[model samples]
Target: MARARICKPCLWTALLGIGFLFIWYFKVLALGYYWLSTTVNAAQWEGSSLWLPGYQVAVEARPIEGLTRNTSGLTFNNETGTLFTVINRPPQIAELTTDGRLLRVIELEGARDPEGITYVQGDTYVISDEHSDSMYWVRIGPDTRHVSIAARSSLGIRIDSVHNSSFEGVSWDSEQNRLFVVKEKLPLRVLVIKGLDVFSESRGFNIDISEWKSSSAASLFMSDLSSLTLHEPTGHLLLLSDESALVVEYAPDGQPIGMLPLWRGFNGLQRKVPQPEGLAVGPDSALYVLSEPNLFYRFERIQKPAVAAN
Candidate 1:
């Protein structure tokens, strides 16, 4: 008889719980918060036209020819005028043109579970080994087709790192003379590696590892950080989140400024990017993104046309 009485409050509570789960699952709340934040902080963009959120998808879901899987982090090589990404499983490095064409796939040796790759300077690049929680400095020359891990410098800090979420992306801030490495999740982290001479041949090293946190960093709403790129010109740091389907830009002071959503309708994307793992910014401020299993996406700012002279 008691079963015949349906408590209205309990039913309403259950419905509310389900609604909340749906919103959370779809990232509606996170996106809303970010949207509100950006709107409220629009004044911060007064003079800067180099905003990340203003980018529109130039190339979407272009398959990297000859590669079928395991394409991760990305970095724009200023010297080569190309892009580089990592393949964790089977461990390899792939170089691509600015428009998503595969230039070459450099066979990587001695790196276990390479998930993130970033170009430091000249022929120097750093690759992050996810499983080992280590970063190795390697060189990739023009005629080079392979990168065998040498006795070069590396930094590994294992502090209760999870199985596969240790290191996800790496970016070199040339202006700051520091390297930024991001952990995938497990309370998503951004770290700054300084004083390590990436080009140093000697055995001695003065490395400093510190967590990068500020008012904005303390409130990063992304579920996971997949990759990161530093805009050396403006010193703006861009972070990519596969789960969030978003690319968020933060000022040098760590203030969140803008965002580019990887959803189907947002930023001229025909379809939501499946899995964005690598992020890079070219000299022209074009954004290059790599998704796992070898898909490439490029986003460029919608340039405003010049007005006629008065």
Candidate 2:
């Protein structure tokens, strides 16, 4: 009987093809897993039942020029009663008074898309560029402006890893001495730094954002949360979504407390605010909302419930 003949060359080629297929399958799976994990961790705060009901007091149309198109980050200084917003397409930080007057504008050229802004102390502020994980500390003086590197870590609160996308919002808790940074969209998480005192000690530190909690993930209702601001007096977080035309207020525990909706009259002015991006609370408790390009809205909080008028 003739011994069974085996095709040695064909067998080797088939084995090589199988090995390549396994490699390709794993490559795609690894990429997909990384994306899925990042998204889940980024938006981990969704489905939180903790939130308050926000009321729509008023919606002022786009009140400024220059801001009509690409507003990214927003912050309010209670001490000065000023609102700061970053217009990314041209990279300009525009300042406005509580009465909706454009006070000043600072150009930030070489900076990546500045997505978040917060006033730390006198003349010192921190800005985050969503395109990169680097954060900048800028010093504004009476006459000259200087920029320095403050914190340079991808230490996002809700992101699963530092390799994910950039950050969007920043809120400083002076009383608690913590910094809260928000990641845009899915698995919305807030990065909390426990001991902010040490932020200056070392360059920066990374905290697992998955551990920090939010009352609600604004992305569930409004998918694109462009910016966030914490109201110290009320412990409420104001979220702005450039795509939803709505601003929502959430409790620290992630509850859906209240919300404010934009009006349609803005279209009549040829300046419709399809995207309400940045948010800041004025000293008077008035909310300042800014949209892309150059549009600003002011909303005074509705009167709180009276206690029997006693």
Candidate 3:
């Protein structure tokens, strides 16, 4: 009878706590952050910055040919003027035109859950395996139909990584020769790697990795990180969130500056991009986004000075 008295109170408290967390995670907190972050950044946004508010979707939810599922992280190959994305289900690297057309599929051998891929100058690229927390440097030539990584060309960072929440995206800064990586969730993280000479013939390693911490990131409003792309011109970083259905842009100094929401009716999107997994910027500065199960979208700059709030 003494224990039964506390049980009812404890159960009520537990139920209340669970309800609050669910609301916070799924809706309330995200809405609050979106309003607050975008409002604050809009005041400080510069015209010269990579203002994502000026973009509107040109092509929305176009299905990529031959891809049934798992069209993941994206990167623009400036050398070839094409885009590349990974499919972890079958472990393949697919080349694509700037539009939603598939060019070729390069088989990726020995990749474990390859979720993120970035072009690193020439025909070289880096692929991040979410399950393994590892990155492999591989080459893709014109005649190449397959890529197999050697043990020496791979680097792993296994620091308290969980299975699906690790290594979601990567982008290379050609000007600085540095690589930036983003984790999916569970304390979302962005790590920068430098001094990694992927083309160096020397087997010895000389790399320094550090976390890219921001005041905004510490209070990151996104439900989860999905992919990221670095705009080479302004050196700004764009972080994509699938659950939030948004892309938050940060200045080089790590200040949140602008956002591009992938929500329907906003950004001129006819339909909401379902599960955005890949993000890239083309040579002409058009934004390219890829969603899972093979949906491709392109957003071009409109003359809008205000964000498309939904």
Candidate 4:
């Protein structure tokens, strides 16, 4: 009986220590250290010290009107000189002008939880459904009101067992005819797929999927991926992270080249960008961003004020 009492106290003490360690690792040490590193890296990328100066928000976060539902991915439509964003609630598409004027909303009945949209070619787009972990090819126009998946071709890739953390964002490389899809989190990966619309004699639409190996290194900079956009002019990638509130710039080789903090102090904003969901780069190299609960933001490269000659 005496020995049992001593062991009981010892066991309770051990359990308490283990619990403290768990909290320290995940809540304190891990997150604290990561935030510190992210801030330092961002400073280096944004400060004038770096060769490639980072971008800053030219305008403030604009409240998007007529978009009542939650917005997800965004893609710049080169042909129209506009942008397209997805609504996951009813799985619809919203067309907006450069200034964020809502042009129209097209209802997509069969697009389940559409989280990403990317323009593939003339009137053709690839939309990703997070719940289904699938991609659908469809076309829309000025008068088009409704769309379905019956006439579309879909390719499903299961990347995560968690339904919500599946495919979250996608970017189309029109020049190379490749598609890059981002797994939301849980070892966040970027899958590069080629031959999306190509076919072979033995295999139909023989799509080849590969991962950008360097994304593993880049993932260390962000918490989770909310959207992705490719800047055609620079052939660089802009990765949006909602949790970290950042837009990370990755080179063609997938190395993290720069990062723009989506915070109030960093950018010319009175408030921070909350829940950024979509990102797109216009043909003029202007950056467009969308946040949940209907918010739009624009960023551009502006000339730095010349320092007075010393």
Stretches > 4 Å off in candidate 2: 1-59, 66-69, 146-165, 198-219, 263-272, 304-310
Residue 259 shift from truth in candidate 3, angstroms: 0.8
**lDDT score for candidate 2 against the true structure:** 0.59
Residue-by-residue lDDT tens digits, candidate 2, 1-310: 8998999999999999999688556645643453354335433322231121222335456457534567767787755667777767767777777656777778776666777888777766777777666556666554533343443323323244343344787877676766677777554555665555423535565433333454322223554567777766556667776665656666566654454555454312233455676777766556677766566676653443211100
In candidate 1 the C-alpha lDDT for residue 43 amounts to 64
Error of 3 at 16 (Å): 8.9
- Which pairs of residues have clashing backbones in candidate 1? none
Best by lDDT: 3
Ranking by lDDT: 3, 1, 4, 2
Indicate the TM-score of model 1. 0.87
- What pairs collide in candidate 4? none
Candidate 3 segments exceeding 4 Å error: 1-46, 201-203, 217-219, 304-310
Q: Which ranking of candidates, highest TM-score first?
A: 3, 1, 4, 2
Which candidate do you rate higher for lDDT, 1 or 3? 3
Give lDDT tens digits, candidate 4, residues 1-310: 4553468888899999998677445544544554555456764444331212345677677777899768999998877888898998877899998888899999888877999999877778889998788888878776777888665678889865476887888998877888989888876777899987722222257779998755444244566788887765456677788887877666576656566778787756678898999988776567788999688888866643122100
Lowest lDDT block of 10, candidate 1 = 301-310
Can you give the lDDT of residue 220 in candidate 4?
46
